[model samples]
Target: MTDAIKAIILGIIEGLTEFLPVSSTGHLVLAGDLLKFEGDTAVTFKIVIQLGAVLAVLLLYWKKYLHIGVNMLKMDFAKSKGLNAIHMFLAMIPALIVYLFFKDMIKTHLFGPEPVLIGLVAGAILMIFAARSRGTKTADTVDHLNYKQAFGIGLFQCLALWPGFSRSGSTISGGLLLGTSQKAAADFTFLISVPVMFGASLLDLYDSWDLLNSDALTLMLIGFVTSFVVALIEVVTFIKLIKRLRLEWFALYRFVIAALFYVIVIL
Candidate 1:
């Protein structure tokens, strides 16, 4: 296959796994390695193209964001309806601090299949625990989550710094454990993800600015657009899936994938 085709495939994998309890970074790492997309350029491609997934979130939640923006401008938090921008900002704090201090360490030492395997299993356990106790006592929706809960979710999001742990998985599982409904957890997860992903992508772009030559740029564009479209579809479908299916299904899927990759990496 052509480089562009490979990029498309990776983009699809990214979109499909980004928001689910399954890890986007883990899938991308495994798929990229399988496709021989290693080295600096491949890493840059993976990090930069995440903007596409962030765009999907922005597009999907534009109305809610706009409401928050307008209300903030008018100094009327109550009029923002159920979408509070401050809550999302607060939820991003812990991850931001963790990423800034340890991003290089993480990229150098832990951005591999081994750490990913451990993270996958650890995160899966959390998902299973949360799934077992879902629905008995939970906040009905995102609007019901207080600042403390949002901050608590942010702390949980720090686990996603460990690649396969997954941002959505960590936050959603945290929400479930904290008594938030699945849909609410998902909504909050998606909301907080927008800023964090965008910031991380920007940092990656700045760090890898010299790598953006013509051919590389073309591949990046293809990957970006492909991921955007695919993520748009997946983001919508995942919300529906959360409403219909148990999160343990995703956790179980992660377990199988992690075990498979564990053997592949070790052997």
Candidate 2:
């Protein structure tokens, strides 16, 4: 496939899976395999393009992050908003440490063709359990949650390092278990993703700075634009669906998709 085609496909995959409890990286890897684009360069391209999806999260929640610093400069650190920002960073520290130490291992070992299958099945099973165990409780508001709960959710967020496990899924499940309402869990999941994804993107660039020339820069832009449009749409739709439906249905999707991949691709 041409770089343009790769850009479009990867962007759509990222947008669709970024919010759901399915790993977008897994889907992108499968897409790459199917499209016959399974080389080191292609793999790097997909990872780099994910910068676009993270950008969507940042764009959608720019005010929260912006105010995190603005409140500090104003010496209004006593504000709850500023405190939330502090909690957010504190929560991020665990993943940052893990990422810093094992970044290469995750990229080199975890996110490969073999592990994609493993992630698909394992994550699907976990989602099934999450759906069943989830109480009638709805975590619809982040304000109701405490700092320790957010940090707990962030710790669960670390499971995404395992390739197929959805970061959103893990965090939401953690939030739910920690007594966050469903919506609160989901909202906090999205909010927490901003730092995690951006940090990963920057970290990737930092590690691969040598390979990111003008060509790579241009391709990353294409991916960012594509993922932005798709993710915005995804965010709007996902919010609506979760508000009115059960996550068990998405688990069903994870099962069927994973089953199909097992039979047709992995096997």
Candidate 3:
């Protein structure tokens, strides 16, 4: 496929799966194989395109995120909301460490098919167990989370770096297991993704260096715009939808996709 079509496909996958825990990177790996997209350009496309989806999550939660910024000036930053943002930053620590240390290996080796397929099946299996919990708590907003809980969730977020183990999926599941209401877990997961993804995209660009050119950069911009707009819609819808829905369907989807990929590629 041409670069434009590749960018569009990458953006759609990034938007849809970025928050779902189904692993957009994993799907993009599969898509790459199917489309016969080879070379580092394909890898760069996949990584840069995610900026779109992360932008979407940021836009949707802009009010909450912005509130923290405005409050920071008032010395009232410690008043609940700022604390939540602090927790998010805390949770980001481990993944940031991992990213700095192993990001190159991740880009070239981890995101490739073999390790990714293993991660997908492993994450799918874990989600099945996580789904069985059907966590029985609820929180309407971020204020309800405790420091310990935030730390725990942050540790879980680190799992997403493994390729098939999605950052949102693993972190949210970790929150649910710790008894945060599903919405809160999902919300925190979404909020946290923006910084983590932004950090990652920047890292990718730093490594991409002279490899990034006008055409690839343009496609990435297109992908980013597309993902950002769609992600905003999905986040708003996700907030409303989570109240009524169970994560079981997503768990099942992961399992089915894992099984299909395992058979096709690994087995």
- Provide TM-scores for the models: 0.93, 0.89, 0.90
Instruction: Give the total clashing residue pairs for model 3.
Output: 1
Looking at candidate 2, the ten consecutive residues that score lowest on lDDT are 77-86
Clashes of each: 0, 8, 1
Where model 2 places Cα greater than 4 Å from the true spot, the runs are 74-83, 134-140
TM-score of 2: 0.89
Better of 1 and 3 by lDDT: 1
In the range 1-267, model 2's lDDT, one tens digit per residue, is 687778787888888888887788888887777877665556567777666777777778788778766765676755554236656775677777788899888878876667877876777776666666746553357766667877888787787777777877777767777777767878777877777888887888777877777877777778778987898888877875654455667667777777787777777
- Screening candidate 2 with a backbone cut-off below 3 angstroms (N, C-alpha, C), the clashing residue pairs are 138-181, 138-182, 139-181, 139-182, 139-183, 139-184, 140-183, 140-184
RMSD of each: 1.8, 2.4, 2.3
Query: Which predicted model would earn the best TM-score?
Result: 1
Q: Write the per-residue lDDT of candidate 3 for residues 1-267, one digit (tens) a residue.
A: 687887777777777777776788888887777777767877877888788887777766788887766665565746644245567777788888888898878887886777777777777766666767866664445677777778888888878888888877788678878778777777788777888888988988888878888987888888888777766777676666643466666667877887787778667
Query: Pairing residues by index, what is the TM-score of model 3?
Result: 0.90
Q: Which 10 successive residues of model 3 have the least lDDT summed?
A: 75-84
Model 3 lDDT on a 0 to 1 scale: 0.76
> In angstroms, how far off is 220's CA in candidate 3?
1.4
Residue 122 of model 1 has an lDDT of 91
Question: lDDT tens string, model 1, 1-267?
Answer: 678899999999988888888889988888887787877778878877888999999998998778777777887765555657678877988988898888878777777778888888999999899888736544778888877778889999999989889999999888888888888888889888889988877877787788779998898899899899999998887778855578788889999998897777668
